[model samples]
Target: MFVNKAYRFRLYPNKKQEVLIAKTIGCSRFVFNRFLSLWNESYQTTGKGLSFNFCSSQLTQLKKELEWLKEVDSHALQSSLKNLADSFDRYFKKQNEAPRFKNKRNNVQSYTTNIEKKNQNPEVSIAENRLKLPKLGWIRFANCREVKGRILNATIRKSPSGRYFVSLLVETEVKEIPKTASTVGIDVGLKDFAILSNGKVYKNPKFFRALEEKLAKAQRILSRRQRLAIQQKRPLSEAKNVQKQRIKVARIHEQVVHARTNYLQKISTEIIKNHDIIGIEDLQVSNMIKNRKLAKAISEVSWSEFRTMLEYKAKWYGRQVIAVDPRHTSQKCHSCGHTAKENRQTQAAFICVSCGHSENADINASRNIHELAILL
Candidate 1:
């Protein structure tokens, strides 16, 4: 079956190409913010937002008026409008909050542009260590893996540390892996990343916690630099020392993110490869994070991201990922079906008050999840 996949790579552009990239990113942000303002005003006056076609026509006229907008790739500007329309659609559907204006001061910036398919040889093609983008010509990239499938579009991003990257979305056929015909349930927790019904536990690496002290030190230095810039009446963006310190702080956070993502990817891949049906708790992480005491720990655990990885990986492997109701999963006795708060004697141990059943709390919870999935 055909699946849409994104392949990301580190981009290394020349000075000229970098300038063009910056211009494209700025123009794209400007277009998005301009139309977003218009959308809000239109909705206030007419009880409706501007249509995509209307915005597109306005962009055409805007380009004519502002010649600088014509300097970058026109497709990128159009993509900005499309993104604005999508934001409004999502807002109307209550999928997300209303769209906000793009900020120039944001550490990360990105712009999307589509590939023209009129010619056999498209502008957005990957070759020996280089990716050719619209208007930016051929820029070298870290070709870590062979890119496969038909390229659709590319999203170019400038990271907080001033590094450039590109994500190429492509359509490709993926074959399901041979299943093990085994079923398993997963209980996710702060102590362990995941506890399986088979009594196996994946330890939480706590990448952020491990580096929290170092990150705090870097951030403190960054704050000092920002204060110095302000004392000298210089903009933080123009202050070289402040910018350098900011990049240092950003790199620390980036390291934590990379480590966490890698760990989650490996764990998710391993689970998807071994199981035919996987049951997990439907955790409302957003609501759970409202507890200020556990908010940092919860965010560090990244339960939502792990679940997302499991779901997509399961789909790719033709496996079933069922999310069962989490209520009483931990408190219920797996062996005797005795449900009570007293059953969970502690965070790590479970003992049934009535039936005298005993087990690891997480493992018992996972077993309950497994039983629920089967019943469902």
Candidate 2:
């Protein structure tokens, strides 16, 4: 089956290339913000937003008037317009909030450029340790893995930690793995990342909590630097110390994210490979996090990210991932089909009053989820 996948790599550009990258990001941001303003104005006057075709046609004229816009990659600017259009589309569909103006001071900045194929040869290709871009030419990047499939586009991003990375989106064929004929249900919790119907538990690593103290210390120093910059009547960006400390704090957060992502990837892959039908709770995490006491714990568990990984990986491996209604999963008795608040005597244990059956709380929940998936 054909699938779209993204391969991300660390980029190490030369001083000139870095400057050009910064320029491209700035130009892209400028185009998006400018077009967004026009879209808002058009909507206000005519009760209709500017269409992609109209905005795209106007971009040519805009570049002509703003000579600096012509300095960066034109494809990047067009991509920026496309992204703005997508944002509006999502907003109108009530899938996201309304599009907002891009700020230059944002911690993370990115620009996407389309890949052109000439005589069946793609302009964007990885050669040895370098990647070819539109106007930036070949730039060095960490060649950690072989990039397969046809390259569609490349997105260059600068992280808050002041690190440059590139994400290449490609279309490729993925062969499904051999079916294992195993079915499993997973219940995710703060204590354990997941508990399978087979009574197996994947412990939550708590990556953020592990590094919270260190991150807090770094952030405290950064806060002091920011206050010092303000006291001196200087912009935080202009203060070298503030910038350095900011990067340090960003790096700590980055480390936590990387660690959590790595763990989730491994676990998701294992589950996908072992089970033909995987059942999981359909958790409304956004609403769950509204409880201030559980917000940090829920965020640290990263259930959404884990579920996303499982779903995409399942599709790639020809496995079915079913999300069952989470309501009463923990409180319901797996053996007797009894569901009541009293059934959940404790956080870790469940005892059905109807049949006097007992089981681990998460295990009972997973079994209920498994049965629900079978019914579906």
Candidate 3:
């Protein structure tokens, strides 16, 4: 079996190339926002949303209306905006929800569409290895990894840590591989990010909690500096100091993301490496956060991120990730197959009222997940 994968490459460029890349990203963002504004207006009047094709066509026409865009690259501009339209379409379809706003395209991320035929001139084989774009021309990109197979599509986006990445969808020949292990289920919690079917528990390090104290201090400092600069009615140059402080705050957020992402990858990789099938509950995190007392801790743990990490990792490792309904996972008794509300006495204790079997709440939930994976 084959899969669609995203590989991040770190770009290294001189000052000039960096400026060009930034400008190109800006142009793409501008187009996205413009389309979003126009689409929203259209929706307001017609009570119907603009189709993906509609937005893409308008975006292409609008670009020609921009004189400066003539110098950059038309292909890149259309590709980026078309990507925005495609993403919104996918989001609405996947979530069974409606799109109402055009998302803000930040930095380093642009999109190209996947038409019927593949791009014969692969990214690796692009002119000057810079990848020519409309208006932007051939801007530099990271070539750390080569693109293989027929390129179906590509998306470039920036992380909060200010890094550029590309996700590629390619058509490849299916390669048969022997299965190494059996299927398993996973339970995720705030206390321990994951509990596996094999009785393995991953402790929630609370990486954000560790840096909370320092983060609070930095935010206070940043706020004070920001207010002082504003009260002084300082010139644009004075704002530079405030900007520096803001960057410091951004760096802290970046650190938190890096640490969390790394931890999730390591844990998910280990799980996928050992199991051919992985099952986890389809938790309603939004509802769970309604608990006022647990909201802070729940957000800190980031269960959703863990699940997302598990999904792609499992795919990469040739494992199946199953998301069972979250309802009653904790209350269900693995021993007697009794699922009742009374089975769970407290947050950490599980005692089946029907079967009289007692166990750790998390463990019982993990077992239930495992059973569900097998059944699925």
Candidate 4:
């Protein structure tokens, strides 16, 4: 089987290379915004926006008019226009919000460049501790693992935490794992990260909550620095202290994200390794977050991320993941097939009103999901 996979690695660039990276990202952003503006203007004037081909052809003239644009990778500039075209297509199809101009401050700093193909192989290559891109030469990177297969494209991005990384999209042949003998059901919650039908519970790490104090302190310092910059009538970007504080704040948030991702990946891998069929509730997280009382807890739990990890890992491991309807899964009595609101006696307890069956609420819900998955 053929599969497309992405691997990300930390990049260490020299001063000159760093400057070039910033210029490339800036040029890509400028190109995207310019094309978006032209698309909107043309649509309002002629009732039709420019197509990808039209915009791509026009980019040649744009590069000639702006010498700074030529300093960056040409393919990366074309990819920016392609991104804008995709955004517009999604907006027209009602799949997403309309395309907006990229802002230097809030927008993500990244650009994509596709690898040229030769003899059915990509031109990009990785050496001992370096990876080569189109315009940017070989860059030193942390060699965590070997990259396999044909490199299709690469996206280089600078995180808000002021860390540079690159994600390589590669196409490879898939090898499935041996089938497992076990199946399991999972119930996810804010209190516990997950409760399994097999009576195992993974405690919620609450990574954000754990680091909230540090983050709040950093934000306070950042706010104070911003105020000082305003008092001095200088641009906030020109203020060294403000920039330093901003990075500090960003680092705290990045720590939280990294912690959560690590925790989720470990548990998801464990589940996929143990089970051939994994059943989980089809949670409507967006609707659930509407509860103001639980929004923070729900968001911190990141059920969506957990589910996404399970799904992709299942596919990679040659397992099956089933999402069962969550309605009344907790209230239903797993022992007697009795379902009622009163069956859930409390937050953590489930007792059937009809059959007097009792069990842990989350465990019972997970069992119901498992049964439902089997029936489906």
Query: For residues 249-329, what per-residue lDDT tens digits would candidate 3 score against the true structure?
Result: 777887887798888888877777778888899988899999999998988778888888878766665678889988888
- Once fitted onto the true fold, the runs of candidate 4 whose alpha carbons sit more than 4 angstroms away are 120-123
1-376: candidate 1 lDDT, tens digit per residue:
8899999999999999889999999999999999999988988999988999999999999999999999999899999999989988998899999889889888789899998676667878778898899999899999999888888899999999989999999898889999798999999999998999999999999999999999999989988889888999998889998989888888898999989999999999999999999999999999999999999999998999999999998888799999999999999999889899999999998989998988899999999999998887
Where model 2 places Cα greater than 4 Å from the true spot, the runs are 118-120
Tens-place lDDT digits, model 2, residues 96-210: 9998898988889999998866577777867899988889999999999988888889999999998999999989899999988899999999999899999889999899989
Query: What are the runs in model 3 whose C-alpha is more than 4 Å off?
Result: 35-65, 87-120, 123-177, 235-238, 312-318, 337-358
How many steric overlaps does candidate 4 have?
0
- Comparison by lDDT, 2 against 4, better one: 2
Q: How much does each candidate deviate from the true structure in C-alpha RMSD? A: 1.4, 1.4, 4.4, 1.6
lDDT of 1 at 30: 96
**Pairs in clash, predicted candidate 3:** 72-134, 72-135, 72-136, 73-133, 73-134, 73-135, 74-134, 109-156
- Which of 1 and 4 is ahead in lDDT? 1
Candidate 3 TM-score, C-alpha based: 0.77
Q: Between which residue pairs do clashes occur in model 4?
A: none
